[model samples]
Every structure is written in C-alpha cells, then in structure tokens.
Target: MSNVIFTSSATAKNGRDGHVKSDDGLIDLKLVNPANNQVAKGSNPEQLFAAAYSACFDGALNLVASQQHKKIDSETNAEVSFCKDPEDDGFKIAVTLNIEIQGVNPEDAQQLAEDAHQACPYSKATRGNIDVKLNPKAV
Candidate 1:
C-alpha cells in the first residue's frame, strides 16, 4: 500500500435530480433528471465517471510510458453504461476503454495499455466490481 497523499470531497444534493458541487466550487453543476430511464436534463453520474476514468487512464499511461523512458502522446476513451440489473434488483455499470498510444509498436502499446490499467486508480477501484473491457487501438 502507498502512503496517503490527498483526499477529495464533493457533495450532491437532491440525489440525481438537483445539483452537485465540489468543495472548491470548481465542479458545480446541476444533476440530470432521468425520465423513462434516460437523461432528460443536465449531466449524470455515468458521464462524470466516464470522463474521470478516461482522463485518469490516459494520465496513468503517460506516467507508465515516462517511467519506461519513453514519450507518448495518447488518447484513452472510456464509455460507461449504467443499467438496471434484474437479478441484483439494482443498477450496474459497464465500461469500455480504448487506448491509443503514439510512437510505439502495436505490441508495446498493448503492453502499456495493460500496464496502465493495473496502475490506474479508477481501474483498480472498479476491478471485480463492474464489467470493464480494455481495447488498445494503438498504431
């Protein structure tokens, strides 16, 4: 385990139909309202999670590449789907990640993509809890 570095705090009001704001007020936004199992207004949790995970994964990839003394400009995209599960009688999430790392061989890029998933905090946190598919589209 690593030493504690920093912690973040954010608050959400009125559940999924009101507002959410970070403690620093940098991420203040209205929550989305779901009608007929679809978003009717504003942003939703899945969107937020997707954005965070994609950016975090890219950062982790860059970090790992740099640690290997290599430079890469890459894009990692995360597609998150939130759906209701009949068996669990609750909501569940599925994620698909496509990572493209530049300036590397395809095999090396795939290796980096796999390594990045292991190093990414979001990936680590969500492991075994959700369905996640990682596809490296490196060229």
Candidate 2:
C-alpha cells in the first residue's frame, strides 16, 4: 500500500443549502440544493464531488497513457446525478463520465478510459457503491 501523500479537510454548515470551505481556504463556496443542478447557481456537494472525481480520473488517464507509451490529449467531465435509493428513503448518486480525447481513435480512447477507470481513486471508491457510466468520444 502507498503512504498518504496529501490530506484535505472541509466543513459544511448545512447539509444541502449551506456553506462549505476547505481548511486550506483554496475552496470557499456556497452550497446549493440539488433540486435543479443549475451550474450558474451556487454549487452543491454533488458538483464538488463530480469535479474532484473528474480531475482524478483525468490524471489517471494521463498516467495510463504515459505508462503504456501512448500519447493522449483529452478532456474529461463527470456528471453526477442525485437520486433516491431503492433500498431506503435516503438518497444515492449516479455518475456518467464523458471523455473527449484528441488525436486518438474511438477504440483507443475507449481503452484508455477503461484503464483509467480501473486505476482512478474515485472509480475505486464508487465501484460497488454507485452506478458509473463511461463514455468516450474521440475528436
């Protein structure tokens, strides 16, 4: 196992429609409710989670490409949806990762995405916990 190289902490006042800020002060934003998922409005936990996951997955993709001696230039976006869980009245989340890769064919892009998902920390955490869909669109 690898040792922890970094750590981050954040606190939220209200569950959905409050405020959250990291200890480092780098991220300070108001949390909004997920009723509409409006990008222009204040962000919610789902959006923050999506941002972190996408960045991590993109880094993993780049690392995979380097490890495989393959060149890849890509943009990845994660769309997270909040839904009610079937098991209970509580809520759950689903994810769809849309990857746009430049200078690669569709097959190669898909392979790279799959490899990244296998290696990404976010994917590993959500593997059995939630639904994640991977879509690779090459350009």
Candidate 3:
C-alpha cells in the first residue's frame, strides 16, 4: 500500500511574522509586532487551532458516518475557545461542534460524533484533553 504524506515547514521572522511552506510553496504570516499576537499579518495560534479542529472533526465525522452506513448531508462547523490555565500557566482549548447532517437521526449523529471525537488527529495530539460537545441539527 502506498501512503500519502503531507509536509509543511514554517519559519518565524521578527518573533512572530513567518512564512509557511507547504506542498504549494511559501505563504507569509506576519505578526502585528507589539500587538501581543502570534500572527502578525495572517492568523494567530488560536485561529490556526480552530481551523484544524474544525476540519479534522468534520473529516472524522465523515469517516464514521460512512462506516456506519448513516446517510448525511450538510456541513460541520466548530468553534474553539482558547484560554489560559490559572494553575499551570498553560493553555486549554474547548471545542464545540455544530454538525448539520441531514437524513441522519439524532442518535446516529451522537454516536458518530463520539467516534469522531476519539478519531480526530487534532484531538489526539493536543497536550490538554480537548473537550468536545456535539450539537446535531434535525435532519
């Protein structure tokens, strides 16, 4: 079996501004200098995390649904909140999944959501336990 590998490289300049090189090429992200933000011109860590979480959860849900023979339409959306831990001086993230899966029952959606939460790579990789709540819309 052939495996497809994805690689991305990023370099930070002037503290926060950096360029990320992917399969396509270089993309720039410059911080606002004294803005106390990690992303100068593009987006900060929180934004990036949100994007990843949303996409990953969606992909995982798709896989679960397909495996379960659950038919679904519509899309998946996630909102991630990043906050500092008062005791550890670290950060934590909470993700809320808003899933629109037409033609699928709420019970099936809940099961799939749980499976997706366990399967998503982003959920696996985070240092702190990622909290996920699923909101399934009526089909």
Kindly report the root-mean-square deviation of model 3 from the true structure over all alpha carbons.
3.9
Q: What is the C-alpha lDDT of each candidate?
A: 0.88, 0.91, 0.68
Give candidate 3's whole-model lDDT: 0.68
**How do the residues 38-59 of candidate 1 rate in per-residue lDDT, one tens digit apiece?**
6366887888899999999999
- Per TM-score, the best of the predicted structures is 2
Q: Can you list the residue pairs that collide in candidate 1?
A: none
How would you order the candidates by lDDT, starting with the best? Answer: 2, 1, 3
lDDT of 3 at 83: 68
Q: Which one wins by TM-score: 2 or 3?
A: 2
Candidate 2, clashing residue pairs? none
TM-score of 3: 0.72
- What's the true lDDT of residue 85 in model 2? 92
* Superposed model 1: Cα runs more than 4 Å off: 34-40
Question: Tens-digit lDDT track for model 2 on 20-137?
Answer: 9999998889877858555546888889999999999999999998998888898999999999998998999999999998878899899999999999999998899999999998
